[model samples]
Target: MDFDPPSNFSPELMMRDAAAYRPLFYDPNTTFYNGHDDQHPRRFNEEVTNDWYDFLDGKLTREQIAAFMLEGKKVAAIANSSSPKVKAFERFVRLAHQVDNYACTPINPWSYYNNPQSDTPQKTSEELVEEAIRDYRAETNAFLKNRYAFQALKALFYAGNRDAFERFFGEVEPNMPRNTLYYRALGYRAGFYIEVKDFCNANLLYAEVFNHVPAMRPVAATSLTLQDEKQWEQCLRAASPEQKTALWALLAFRTGDNDRAIRSIYQIRPKDPLLSLLVIRFINENEGRRWSLIGPPTKDADPKANHMKEIPRETFDLIRRIASEEKTENPFLWYAAAGYITSWSGDYDGANSLYDKAAGQMKAGNKEAADQLRLLRLVNALSRITEVKGDNVERLTEELRWLYKQNSYPGYGEGGMRYKTAIEQSATYLSTLYAKAGRPELAEMLDHSSEKIAQPGVVDKLIAVLENPRTPMEKLIVDMYPYTAEEFYFYKALQALHADQLIEAEALMKKAGKQGMTELYTNPFNDYILDPLDAHTRKHIKEAKVKYTPITLIQKMREGEAKIARGEEVYNNSLLVGNAFYNMSFYGTSDIWRVPLLNASIFELVPCYAQEMVMTSPAAKKYYRMALKAATTDEQRAKAVFLSIKCDRNDCYLGPIRGRALCDDQRYMNQSNSPNWLDRDGFGELMRYANTQYYRDVIRECGYFQLYVAKHKR
Candidate 1:
């Protein structure tokens, strides 16, 4: 995919003038391009005329150019060579990008060979099988020790020569060595068996490979082996110490035993790619978004219970400790993991350096490794750059966009397919960043570029709402991917309000209010009702208030209780006690001056309490006296008054009245189920007044408020 220059962005200047644009090189020192230090900058050699920038600018004609990510904070000798090996290394790097970015199988004619189609010619299955068998027989006799036996076998299997395959397999099955042909054939057969649901055969093939070459078990164990616990236990018993520990950690994680998973993962000494990936995902599940093949779980029902912004210090230290050790063949995994850990820990500089190291290692090694690492760095960088301050983040984001643009892997080849996906996701994320940075045009373009990219139906549309606001908001709710039905309704109501459809907005807001507990923090009536209402619209809003708001019901219930109660003073005293308890619990002292520190003041509090008690208490007492005027017995009057006080107390605790709105607000239960301001204060006010028999009875008896409590209790 290509980037079209937005009105604000200049492609020509970005290409020609280095000063006009921030360079994408991995810098090692603090050099401020726009008043913030560019992390891990790569220097352009004075002698080397064909730098990466020159290549991108089309000034350099060379097919390959040497690019360096400075090693640590020091300069390294540039390996300037154009040998075949160097060219191969360059292709490998591009291949890595292709594979990592476009992570899906390529659709090609070869894979479509089974289909009968003809501009030229098509062979029948029987004829293909006959040819394969003839080739196998001739080759076996002519070259008894042929290295291409697996290829012949694969062809025969593909052509439906099952009998021939069986015979050939019997001949080579017992003695096949642990090499490319053997493992490749084993993998193919295992996959075939799995496709056929022949678990028994698949298990045997996987076991043979695992037992013979444990280091290569990742290919086999990547599938769901844990479904059959007995077999998994056998595989576990046969694994090396490092592999065993990693497996244990993964198993523990899958089963929701985080403490054990952490303990087992810490036991792993050597670097393992699978383990690194698992650990990064595990950490992500805790800190950021949960990664799942099925996409993220519904926002409210998020699988991760321990949602936090930062991981434990020990977790970060362990990852860094491993990253700092001797570099392994798969050092990119450690580097990427360490980068993610630090990034999550708010150490963007450290993360940038670690990613630079990983990129450098990838440059030195194979493209396959580099590809995955590149995307890993991109994801971490995009997420972390948002948290970073200054103009540097913008510069970095632009550089990342350039990187994505320059690394386009074309064609429908396997590498290209995966690279396409990589670019799409990367571009989508970039669009979000652009949107946040007030570059909506660029964001829209990037989002459009990724329209062909397959994503979860819900999340994709949620993202679409941000990218394409011109599209009707109603069209974006293809099932409300990240939010609950009620949340969607609430969001939709807000959208309607923005569109000036006040009646529709009010109706939708009422609909949302009817679902679960209506949030108090952001009152739809006040906060979302942006414009002044006309008489007709005001009527709709009034109807909405009567339909959705719980204040009326609570007041009526209070009035009924007041008409039967004996002593209104007793309830007032109880309320005062509850207020005092809340004040002491929240402020940590009874000093009136300290109350202002609670983001409120005593000046407002005294009158608020006085007005609340004096005005209401008298009316309630009058109602109680009127209801009990005919009571000939003291017992009846006492019982009537007792019930009245309970009703008033219940209102104080759980009613959606003016003062206790925050206690039942649904915003606290937003996507991550993270705590809000009320949670921070220990929900002291609600806790002090709620949980009494009165409050419990009101919630249990009042059908309207039962679901509200269930949905928003936490």
Candidate 2:
């Protein structure tokens, strides 16, 4: 008899194997391009490869990718399914994390609306009904012989045509052979019965299907859940041999019969994807004690934490064995889930081995999805380091950095957003670790990297860094994000503010704000209008309409390329130049861009450079200032005062990159080391502002302010 390796088995080989799959020099910005690769070759053809690269690089829009995939799916049905084109099509969809074949029902004819108009031809009620019936017939005709005929029948039921649906459903039942069509049709009819609340017929049909088709037992179980407890119990009692054991396992778990549930789960063989998932769910629920991490608690007052407790070694092995036996399109997820359980159970080495296996399997199939696998592996590795695991910290951090590089590389496809949540979580954990271990620089670096999916925890970290008196003003003022020129300028302003160079700060702030607003603040009049306009309005339409303008250096470069491509000379133009006379104000700067009060407030909370913006029109600031002065209500006055102070504080403290740095120059993650007079938290300063009773009276909604007030009460 063979026994499993002990929990403390060496994971060095597994770690090394996992690291080998990661691409060298992975950077999201520079990996993929529009043309075919000569140096770094791919297995796919030119068009397919280009499309993949374009999709990954953010060049291909979501709509374009969707349309391409849809067309490919349609063509694959009629064309030689085994052709390279079809394979490419299938691979493309998989790369984008979409299914090649989708189960989509036709739209109901009743969903269409006929607009009433004097000039439009109108049909009689009988003709209208006849038209709807004809359309429905055509729709059913198209899908009847198709694999999704059952879905078409279900569509009829959804449109409230119960009589027609029943008639057609019955007609299709007897002729339906024991194939995918037969299974699907039976499932749909059973679902229809459930929808009509005919529990007896639904249960009878469910029992028949569950008994005959082992594959659809999972679908049947989902439907069974909607029934009353008595009805479900009756169905379970009448379940066929194939489904009886699964249903028993489910019922046992539901009723807290742990031993029976575990036994039933173990007895289950491979190839039962749904049952396997159910077993996994049972294990997770028991292991979590409450599946709060999976989602919010069902009860309002329920605790929101994962209370992890190690199960018996036998139980753990059983679950792992079940996951290993799974033979599905994506068993890697099950493997990863098992790994998560092991890690949570304090078996770190066991978890690493499991992760390594999952990553290996996923990489063998689809290289694109392997990024997600790597992300999971790295996250688990980070989770294992509780009290700074010596060399493991640097190793894990390097792996995380590699993961970031892969996610950022344009060659990876449009997965940055998809993988962002995991990446951010890992970054947050690593940052927190670094901060606690007396590595503020690394902590701050990781903290900045985690901003894409940054939470309130990120704000807390920023507050901590700023509050640390030992942290140099230069370090704190470092450009946390320098991806964009606008951000760079804004960051520099913060640095200037820290250095007490108010003039430079004000100028930089203005420049940064202008850059941010120029791109984001588009003209409202660009979209189509609803109706005819008055003569006066029509006369002003030409002046009101404005074209899109490029503001930042990147935008300017793109626009210039398009213009040059159109045979237009764009360089050496005096019209594009700005002549600034800056030594004028009390801050020693000329007229400059300043962030709007609303944007300033938002940036203070979120702290991303892209969130920084100036007033689009100079008059808007004057108008807003006038509005502030005209305010009479306490709430209005309080908000205005806070906004003013926030803007002033930001102008004085926030700065951009000044010297060489370890990180990239992207505005999104830039951070400076400089310190400023105002705290990054700004709570104390705000509390001071709200010192007056009237200010305090209207600040009830602001929780931050409330907390500050509570901490420093008179």
Candidate 3:
């Protein structure tokens, strides 16, 4: 009955404005650290387009440039103007293309390991490398020179001329402006350091790139590698305060030890925006680990201290201290995060107080933040409700409606708010409360499942409400009920049929409408008792000539019962009724009848149904006994005895209590409680007709009977 929330935190709501960093947080599309591929490329394209616009002095429109760069349109075709700026832009674009041809091709790190014969990269020619170097030497304009230097560095690095790459980097890096292009060149040098196995220098360079280049931060962080503590310390020692913060950010991402990273970055720069991302990630991870409000209480003596053990003491203190200081860029973020942690730890009062403060600090018209605060407030309200009765339900109706609305239409709220966790958690909380309030029908409706609905009386209560919902709570339950009235009627019919209430079952089946016409692939009154485990029996049942819908089958059984009542062909009528009951069971071909009724698999019906109704086949056994009493010949009597014994054998194997002692295959037939029905009087009567074709058929087909006779003879 435990219901764990899908997730308790909405990273999209928290970081909607921080689009560059959004991919770094929890995304349903990708695992942690495995970010969205488009984030970096999108940022890179935006920055590059801006730089290109400025470089061309707006000679070509931004739209034209975007189409040229992103849509693979030729630059010459987009910029047909003969101005010097456009001409210079053309040269720059050509050099950029040459550099990108080598740089942008994806390098599969596991190519050699995964496929030894994987194709190698197409090499950049020496002539192209030399031409890039010449372009850098000739360019005098600072912007054009930086662009040329980047191309030259990329070309040399990709050309496998490590000596030339280092020589050119040493000459050009000092004069290069610390912009995205400069960071791009620096990233190449860092890759070289990693190639040379000097992880310390490589990590240091990557940290610098991470700190300076916002568009390339993901790439830099992914590339930064500290093989051991020695290299980590070496990088930290050589890094500036900003670079050190970037290194800590990478550490937080690589290892989920965000508390240390947040503190380390906060110590270096209290106002660092990275602190917000790290703190939000930390809070979200904790939220996922926190216990549900209705889950098992913690070991703490106080009933209110349910999830106190889930929150890390140190991290909680750190978040509280930071929120109190209000130093981070998003003070509202810190306060809201702190409030959520407090709420999860069972301090509803303290949590609401912080939430109020967070609301006060939140920027007006910030819908995402406003929605987050409202959700938290709702959670606090829901957590405080110890009982679900008239007063509490009335008081929280609006909030509950809002929560349900958000879940029903995800785009209705501040879009992409992670409400799945809250929705599932609230359902569990409300369902548990309703159960305690002696309203289990409402509980089952809120947390509807085949297993819960299959519990006795749940369906009857559902049927009552569906028939006439007088109360507001009943109407609400009806609104939230997942299945239609027809399905409920069909389910009721199934239960009735299980209990041998044929008249009620027929009435309910009539109310089931078109659902009652769902066809069974095989005959329900087929005299051959099917073993579900037997391949041949399954094939034979699949190829059965007779097909009957639920209504038709029930009507047929009713007709047979009427014939039995009139004592006309009483033995045949009894046998037909018995076969119908038997085939409707878990072991029989017509178990497919329950598939649509329960919305469960044919395989799952046995476990999903009440064990006694299915496992014992009591109705079928009763009818078989009636058949034995009316039988006029040894063949008829023998058939009745054998079919009844099949029911007893099934009961031994499947009955919840009797099944336990008889389950061991090695001790199956020898068990003290095992039903050796073949040794009983009916079986003795069947044996008296040993020469009959019916008895011969039973002996040939029934393996258990053969084993029993063999044991008795021994």
Candidate 4:
């Protein structure tokens, strides 16, 4: 029933740096936040190191502090420590970065609202990414603080410092936006490889990015030629915007299969300069020589303004004239003739029709040169249409959408900003369509629209739709209830959705995407209820040997009711949910099989009630201690505090905290810790109770958490 966020959510937000949260040089007046601020500028005055050490008072034990200090010796062995302070810092980090500390809870967006606001804007996602990149660039210097290490490591990897990259990879936060940055880096790497005449590896990376940012592409041949690389031409063809477009154009031209490419370019908004640039490049490249200002001038513009140098008036007009067409057309002629064209962007189906007619025209004994000229004219006409900016957007929206969807529209070609514009236009069109259609429901359990909810016995109808086989009704229902995984209950909803219920019937048909007024029968129903269990018992299931049976999924979750509970923060779940699964598989693939599904099962199954303890309660205590030891470069003391607390606890339980909980022990991040928090944060056994009990208070608020805890009693 909920609405998805508009697709226009800027990717930059995900890139901001997290180090900005730390106080800038201990300004007590403004210092509300004090986590790892890697971006903190180097100190200006005499170092007031003691101020940091003061913050750790009372929370961490002496033993833990010593353990944290001793741990840094390993890091010191690899990279030259900036100062003795590094060893002291690592000692505390070792203790803090325990597997026990890692387990506890998933992130709760709602909890953020309760916390005191910091004066700082907090790091934007992009800034964080930049910080990571910046870290990568610096070849020397071990990370002084635990908080900023992950970001710096990411930067090192991006900078291609192999030593820093490997070290950082070993310690990266498993859930950091690895894909986002990785793709960009990979794209650059691919381009680099192409430049060096390494076509095979270059293509592999290019193909990888293209898959995620689907409908995405390459670099210039000039550098390759300058380097005297043997495959300079192939690299240029692979990376250059102009060459890539022509290749696609030629592919479409020869085989008449331009659906994918045409659709991709057509998706680009009309005003995008890259679109014009692509056109200009296509023109010059197709002719085997550059042309005078066909569109925008090819001079560099201000990066901030992203200005498009004006095309010559004569060129603009010539293209404009060709754009005013309704006939089926081919756009390549537009480039040959320096004019615009109507019709689609050489879509295979549309281009096939025009290609036949052009062939017939040549068969009539037309002059060979004249026929070639006419053929060029067709290319001009179609290309011009792609170039033309439409009037009255409302009237032209559908046409523009069709145009945007065309293969050769040049929207997503390899130019700098083209893909963005294409993404923007396609997203806008999608938003408009959704608004017009009235927030189309996923046709699971209807809870949003008044019309859907108001019908007689509506809840029942919603239940029947949940039972459908085509859709993931069980999963959907489980999500809606936020309860344990047992498949009973919702009986009232099922009975109501039975045959002869028109409203529910309509909903069922809607799930199936059907238009019907006839047979208003209810969906089939099955019973799955049993007497509720009275006690918890460990009846090991499958290979993992986990599950609290007899207790049922619902009852187990009640065991870990948060001593204090924070409300759920409903961030978009599907993608993040997938990401967690990806991380799990990333860790468990070779080391453990059933990784994706196993991680997915746990991610979805947990009510995440332990968020309070795992993130805020115990973990926060250690974080303050690290900041304190960092004051006099006392890495030794910090390690003791971490080990005292972390060693006694199983780190496997703290995965969510390590992933998103902002723990002091972030230095342990890597592919290995994805499935288990203990592996990420905890050392041995520090907690006084079972791992689940330590965070049990937070888990109880969730019916699902209670079910899991009770059901999975070991």
User: Which number leads on TM-score?
Assistant: 3
> Which of candidates 1 and 4 is the stronger one according to TM-score?
1
- Please provide TM-scores, in order, for all candidate models, with all chains considered together: 0.29, 0.41, 0.73, 0.22
How well is each residue in 236-343 modelled by candidate 4, as lDDT tens digits? 345445334433332332233333333233343322222332333333222222111111223445543222223344444444333323121333233322332112
- The lDDT of model 3 is 0.74
Q: Please report how far candidate 2 places residue 449 from its true position, in Å.
A: 11
Q: Candidate 2, which segments miss by more than 4 Å at Cα? A: 1-174, 178-201, 204-234, 241-269, 279-318, 324-333, 356-365, 368-373, 387-390, 406-418, 449-714
C-alpha lDDT of residue 241 in model 4? 53
Worst 10 residues of 2 by lDDT: 574-583
Worst 10 residues of 1 by lDDT: 4-13
Task: List the candidates ranked by lDDT, beginning with the highest.
Answer: 3, 2, 1, 4
For 1-714, candidate 2 gives per-residue lDDT tens digits of: 011111111111122222211121112223211122233122223434454445345444444444455444344242345544345434435422221112233234554465333233222233333333344345432322332344445445444456666787676566455654565556667777777787656756664555455445444544544346687667656655556555654454335444455555345544443343344334434533422221112344334332233355666676687557666434665576677667656566887888877776664656544655565556566656764455666555446556555442221222132344444455566567666776554465555542321333443344434434343322322323223345445545544533434455656656665543453232221211111123532332332233332233223433433563464532211111100111111111111223331122222332342222221121212222333555555454444445443334334433432111112236424565463634344455345445555466536544445655676675
Clashes of 2: 44
Quantify all predictions' global Cα lDDT against the true fold: 0.41, 0.43, 0.74, 0.31
Give the candidate number with the greatest lDDT.
3
